[model samples]
Target: MIDNTSLAVVAPEILLLVMACVIALVDLGVKSRLRNLTYGLTLASLAAVAFLTGSEAATGETAYGFGRMVVSDSMGNWLKCFSTIAMMVCLVYGRPYAGDRDMLRGGELFTLAMLSLLGIFVMIGGHNFLVIYLGLELLTLCSYALVALRRDHTQATEAAMKYFVLGAMASGFLLYGLSMIYGATGSLDIATVFKVIAGGQVKHTVLVFGLVFIVAGLAFKLGAAPFHMWIPDVYQGAPTAVTIMLGTAPELAAFAIAIRLLVEGMLPLAIDWQQMLVVLAVSSLFVGNLAAIAQTNLKRMLAYSTIGQMGFVMLGLLSGVVNGDPVFARNAYSSAMFYIVTYVLTTLASFGVILLLAREGFESEEIADLAGLNQRSPLYAGVMAVTLFSLAGIPPLVGFYAKLAVLQALVVSGSPFYIGLAVFAVVMSLVAAFYYIRVVKVMYFDAPITATTVAAPAEVRVVLTINGALILLLGILPGGLMTLCAQAIVRMLSS
Candidate 1:
């Protein structure tokens, strides 16, 4: 029977759903070119949701709802809070860009984005395999529609088709794996599967087979190497606003599910899965860095850069269960969490700058488009430069600390293998620095492509400044956020 506690557990999600529907209907009456009413209502809803989730996370309570199909715990609540805030920022930065391109003729973009965010909330709270799968499908379906929202553009339509076909296949892989696990354990609940696997009653070969498919699906979602074919095309082809929306908050959702499935549900098979992660991480580093070097398009380069960054996340994840010991589990997972959060923060600033530079009928996609950006608009150039430097893992930046935290986790494992992997990651970071620095150099040293100064809405400028400042501020003093992540992970594990 549903109770008050159950309703409270999903208050934010319920609020988001209702607001999305309301905004859709209200947007039908919105006659402004910018859909100001729809935009304001969406932001207000997101702010309220963020507040609710933040309050829940701060309480550090764990509550199970829907007969244990979903959970509201510190980790999930914090992730939801962060994801909501990221969505708000994405809409703010994307509004002008979307308006200029005539993509806001209807309220579909606002409605679709909220629905996708709601899907992310479900994925984070899901405690059962089927619930997680349902959430995944909801998020992917919305994404496909958003990518194709520019109905008149051939490139956008093509990107949507590619995303649909590839996403469908990945979803199938995940579903099949979940089915095998369910068949083996006679349960769809994550907690039940964990206890069953720990009991060692199931066939090891069968479990490992299912795990292979599960990891493959997850790698595809994370845009890791070998399964990241859809990212670059979609990023380049879709509207820049849509690309940022797709790239930012959805990533936190992917990380949440990774923790839910791999760490919480299937950790008994750590020995088996950790090895698979090693291969994926190393290959992603190699492929992401090398391929990025050949790209002239900024979005595609960042897409490849994303693959390389996910490798770091994988490294942190694999280091959690060294020699079958889970002593470092909290630290490792927290480091991974920190890495992803900071990555998303830095990505917002980078993409915000890109969105600002792009004018009507001009894509501003090529690296050459940023030539002498420093001379034209020092503020955005500095923001973009800082973003690129952080991505390269340079000293005293959030990216450097993120990489350092992961490497530190590996080294603390007392495993020569993990330590060596850390060294390899460092080398790859060095390789990645080349492309990132090249972009910086273009902005600072190259001749200006246009003499007109870059302009932005006052709100965009304020948010962009804060976003860039956070990168630097967090890099300098990352302890508070790092501690929060560690505490959240510990609470989740203990509860």
Candidate 2:
């Protein structure tokens, strides 16, 4: 029998699942005129689930059960809440475009989004290897179907195939790692492996092998360097709304997984993976920023930027310069969590504008398409400006403050290597800024391309307004959010 702990821990996911089923059934009994009804219910359900997560945070409840296969802690609470909000924003961003295109209102897209979010909760709460794999596969399969939802489009079909095949390969790497670790310590829970390693119960060779594959798999999810080849193609080809979900929500889920596996599972052997993380961080920073400069496609550019942002999170992890320790493991987990929140808001605002530009034959993925945007619509120009600046880590923007906090944490740890890495980060910031500034220049300086006009519904405009203001507000006055991050991470580590 399942325990009360597991039941309470998984309440939010269960609520979402019930809502998904109800929406599908509601589609049948309801009139075609009530298609908007499904959309409304879907968003409302997610908002309700987020409220539950908030309650969990407020009460500081952490539950573990099913042999520790599922966990509901500070980490999962934050991840589920953030991902649900991101999903809602994706809907807000996409509804107008999807309606304008006469896309199917089968209620499938929103349903699938909630299902995928269910998978994310599983991934965040997973404490066992098989549970993690199952969650990932569930989430990935939904994503593949969602990407191909616009099936009449050849580009959408091609992107789905690419995502499926590559995603399978990444899963293979994760399974291989799980197998190796099981061989080494005869355990599956992440916490168990940490115990086994600390107890010296595993052979050195097997442990090292397991560690390598695990990092490789996690890096792919995080979209860190050497494993990021799929991101740009997927982003460019998928629908703008789906792209927003992929670019924002999945990164936060990956961030949560890494915290559980590394901080809870592998800290006993921190020295072994610390340098490995550094290499990944540096590679992602340099490659992501530099490649983005040449991309004309806005989705692709943001995809690269996502890679760099993950690298910054990796820097916090590798430095061991967290809330507590340097030479020993610490709780930099909060820094990673906080950074993901800022990135989510920044990307939603960024992509919300991209969605607003989508017309009958054009989606605003290309940077050149934004030329003369200020003349076309000053509201769009202003929103894009704030979004772009925040992403480039410009000051007073939440993005800049997020980056500053991470770098400051690392620098204060007082390690020469981390200090030098912080310098490299500064240089890459310049590289990233060059691309961000280009969007501003095109919007302000150039004329709209070819007398083109973009039509967005009022709903999309409202989403754009909220997204824009939040980015600026978080950027300028980040004290409250930063405090939350600190508090959350402390709860996770000290629990």
Candidate 3:
């Protein structure tokens, strides 16, 4: 009953596992100061895996592998490819910063990052609830270790503890909700769960209650308001390198799972879940923008920005099913996918600049610390300014197009509630823009706090430049990536 075809679908994941283990062993003989060896190996592994994913997607075959426990489709493959690229960029941006903070001493950061990426792969490909949960736990466990990597720092330790406790509770909520669904539907496979729900014999009350918990769990994962108490503390307290790792790539993984659980596995329950998302979205937009304006810590401010961004993503999701009309589902979900991808790209560049500014015995974490960034380095200041503009949804930037796509998705639904939601989101963007622009003002208008010359590794410079350029380039020519996202969603939905 072994299927070689199933193995083919997961070839990249298998290769990643082998590479991670090899790196772990190879790192043992490597010296601490020469951590570049570990970094090179990690990047090589990601490159190889990304190549494999691209090849898989090119085959244009949707593979139901491992007894349907996992799936390989264009959507999953593309996400995997981008996730690998994101992690590679993260490591590139994080390297010198990690070196300054003594974080690369033992290769733990590299190893943990690789493992977390492996977990993301699993989450993206999983087709069974148990498989998805296992992947979620894997990613969270690695994240906990990474957050606490700077064990000597009291703040890091405290952040790690808080993350652990809250993350555990969220896991419990998701598990209990999944168990209830299982008890009702008598299936562990996501496809089967959908079929069971579609059959219309399940208890309505039980399923709805289960959905309540599932949404709560997802809100926690997405860092949406009311369940987002942990993001600010964790983002502020963790090492900037860890914060960059936590912010960018994992979001793509999170988006994948959200698609898997809500759209794919629970489509029959759209009315219920869409209503829940509306509530989460409105609250997140209201709270995230309002809170971000008050933050002096740059990381914490970005954390709140993250919450508001997630709200936009939720708006797209909620608009997918208006009054039981799923005619616009693909458009809505694809728009959300596009939004998350662009947000992650902008986030990486924003944090890359922060990492570049940080030096030994100094953490450039406060917004005021960005004073005269334009004077120190106009290139990076321009990069940071573009990044902020993108986040604020300014025109001629990818973020603006992303927001436009999602708003269009909402308007296409032709529902008053969704239209109102779009208006509210626009207002929130305006509120959020004030803080983002304030950072740019400090960078250009205020005086330099120190005379430190801003310099990054050559690799980091190249990557950051490409990252910033892509945001603007995509804004100008949004067709290619937008088409790719739409095609992936359509293909996945059809298969």
Candidate 4:
């Protein structure tokens, strides 16, 4: 029986859904001058959802709804809260950019973004394979549409098609893998599958085959190397606003689903999946760093940087279990969760600046376009510099602490192979630093490429400042958020 108690577990999602429809309908009557109303309402809805999620997380209770297909717990709630804030900040940063490009003409961007967040909520809460896949499709479908929203732009259209085609293929890979697991285990519920696998009766060959495809699907979604063909194209071709959305928030959902399928549902198969993740991590670090150094376009460079970041995230995940011991699970997974959170924070600020520098008829995507950014807008330039330094894992920045946590987790495993993985990750970080620093150099040392004053809405400026400050603050005082991540993971595992 679906009771009020069960329904309350998903109250935020329900509220968000209703608000989304309301916003879509309200947009119909809003004129361009009054379009801010629609944007304001969207922001308001996100804030409310965040509040609800935060409240739920504060209770420190884990609840299962819909026959355990959906869960409300610390990890999921915190992720939802952060994802909402990320989207809110994204919309704030995206408004001027969208308005200048006429992408806001029909209020579709706002609606689509909210719908995507709903997908994120679903993905985070899902505890069943079908439920998770439904969420993934919702997110991907919304993303494909948003990428192509600039229907008149050939590049956007092309990028959208590529994303759709590749995304569909990945989905098929994931579905086949899930079906194989079901056939082997006789269930689709994640907990049931885990129990079945733990029973030691599943066919080894079939399970391994399914694991491979599942990892491929996950790699594609996370934009890890060898499966990351879509990221650069999509980031460069899509509107910068949409690119920011693509880069930041969906990542939280990806992390959640990874935890659900690999950690929560397939821990018995950890040795197998761990081997796969190691290869993905190594290739991602190697390719992502090497490829980024050659990119002149800022967005494309960031795309490659994202690939490297995902590699690090994977490193933490893969190192969780060694020799059938799960002693390091909490540390490793929590580090990964922290890494994703910090990465999303830094990414939002990095892309936020790119979006801010974009004027009408100008995309500001080229690294050269940021020449003399220090002279043109010192404040924004500083913000961008902080973010870049953070991404490079420079000390006294949140990104550095994020990296340290993961490396520490890797080292804690006491496995020489994982220790070597840690070493390689550090080397890749060094290699990746060159491209990141190059952006700062261009901003500070080169002459201005454009003379127009770089002005943005006050809200964008305030949010960017806060975003940049948080990156620095969290880096300097990493204990609080680190503890939060650790606690969330502990709760998740315990429940």
> Against the hidden true structure, what lDDT does model 2 obtain?
0.83
Measured with C-alpha atoms, the lDDT of residue 329 in candidate 4 is 94
Whole-model Cα lDDT of every candidate shown, in order? 0.94, 0.83, 0.91, 0.94
- TM-score of each model, paired residue for residue: 0.99, 0.96, 0.99, 0.99
What is the C-alpha lDDT profile of model 4 across 350-463, one tens digit per residue?
A: 999999999889899999999999999999999999999999999999999999999999998888988999999999999999999999999999999777888988888899
Q: Which ranges of candidate 2 are over 4 A from the true structure?
A: 29-34, 321-331, 450-455
- Poorest 10 consecutive residues by lDDT, candidate 2: 321-330
Off by over 4 Å in 3: 32-34
* Ten-residue region with minimum lDDT total, candidate 4: 28-37
Report per-prediction Cα RMSD to one decimal.
0.7, 2.0, 0.9, 0.8
For residues 115-226, write the lDDT of model 1, one tens digit per residue: 9999999999999999999889999999999999988999999999999999999999989988888989899999999999999999999999999999999999999988
Candidate 4's TM-score reads: 0.99
Clashing pairs in 2: 397-475, 398-475
Point out where model 1 deviates above 4 Å.
Answer: none
How do the residues 361-447 of candidate 3 rate in per-residue lDDT, one tens digit apiece?
A: 888999999999999999999999999999999999999999999999999888887888899999999999999999999999999
| Local lDDT at 98 for model 4 | 84
